[model samples]
Target: MYIPELYKNENQEDIQNFIHQNGFAILVNQTDGKLWATHIPLVLDVNADGKQVLVGHISKLNPQGESFKADDSVLAIFSGAHSYISSSWYDHENVPTWNYLAVHVYGNVKIYTHEQAVNSLKKLVDKYEANSENPVRVEKLSEKTMREARGIIAFEIEITSIEAQKNYPKTEMIKTIKISFPN
Candidate 1:
């Protein structure tokens, strides 16, 4: 994605925080020379090597799940608050524009085994259920449900590069004030 220098944001902490806040992400990849995308929730963690990792799963029946393989290039997108900006809001006339923030994470895909998938699912549940009065842990799942989960295709992405951008009106535009004097 093209990002102007003015809007470019490269803070590692900010990127990580955004991912955690918006765990649901869009996964984009190429399959059979065609573009494919999947929407899923991801669990973010840091490995011993201090590298960031993303884990998620897709239905085994999803064709895109089969298309992804280890070492393949992939992109995970996390979008933040966004809204339309009207030109009328500016002190001077200007074209309407959209103000928003987005982070693009590029990585190499790694398909995880059944056991790893189960662990990842538990981590996801733990993260989301942490605030509940009675947290529902993955271990509490019924045997039948666990069996069904085995049919899922779990994967991890080792983030190689990340690009974040925040788009908004220039400070001058937002601060501009109109003052009139009687002629």
Candidate 2:
């Protein structure tokens, strides 16, 4: 991700918070020299050793599932809120601009078997929605539905590294805001 100095997020906590707040993200992967992305809700996680991970599932019949190889890397893009800022908002005369926050997580996606995928989904659900008063209610499928649901694929991205940004530019008067990933 190309980030300007004023927009770089160097704080680990802020990056994690942004991901948690925006669970729905664009899961990006590459295959056959093609870039593929799926919009899905992701559950953010941290292991006992404090490594960042994400869990999500995709349709089994989808091209992404069919083409995913064991060695492919994936990216989860979590885009946060932004608002248009008129130069009038600034202390000095300047063109209108905007303010926003975004985070990109890159890692290798380890694909799981149907059973493993389902279990991962369960864990993801419990973790992401743990704080919600009204969390998403995953339907309990019947034997047949379970079998069909199993057809769906799931994967986990162990975040090997990260580069993130929090969008607050440095104006003439206001200093730039700094944020870091894995905060």
Candidate 3:
């Protein structure tokens, strides 16, 4: 979250797109006296109040889920492609570095009710299965399969802040290098 001014991306549109493209994010929060983290697919949505939120779920057996409380602060990190930039790539001597894109979303937790959780799960399924050749839907799922939902805890994070960063070579520099290397 320590983004240098030069690497910071303040474009809201780009940040949202990044989150959508990299929907699997690491959710972090403090539980009891220790830090808890869960990697899950989170979808961005607008609530009935028109406030943006991130929705996701975790196994009910997960300790992280047991400790979640309304208004508890949490962090969701979405990471994108990264690669090592060798010092040899530069004309002058320089240290090697890594370039990547990432977005850190801060929010407050809001546990969903049973009905709300089911609805959220339905939307999540529909979103991912939309383009599948044989798409499956929550409404069409068998009762036995749907009963498994009882074992999970769905929640929403009311977004409070977002910090996005992209650390990469300038476009012209990359183009020039590609032209020189002919690859």
Best model per lDDT: 3
lDDT of 1 by residue, 76-145 (tens): 9988877777677787878977777888989988888888889888999999999999999999989988
Among the numbered candidates, top TM-score falls to 3
Weakest ten-residue segment in model 1 by summed lDDT: 174-183
lDDT of 3 by residue, 1-183 (tens): 998898898888888888888999999998777888899999999998999999999999888887785337899999987777776777666787777889999998898988899999998999899999999999999999989999999999999999988756374333234222100
RMSD of 3: 3.3
Q: Which digits, one per residue and each the tens of the lDDT, describe model 2 over residues 1-183?
A: 888887788888877778888888998876556888889998787644687788788887778776667446788888877767665555666786666777888887777777777777677767766789987634454567567656778877888777777766454654333332222
lDDT of model 1, residue 59: 93
Clashes of each: 0, 12, 0
Model 2, which residues run further than 4 Å from truth?
A: 47-50, 127-141, 169-183
User: Of models 1 and 2, which has the larger lDDT?
Assistant: 1
Candidate 1 collision pairs: none
- Could you give the candidate ranking by lDDT, starting with the highest? 3, 1, 2
Q: TM-score ranking from best to worst?
A: 3, 1, 2
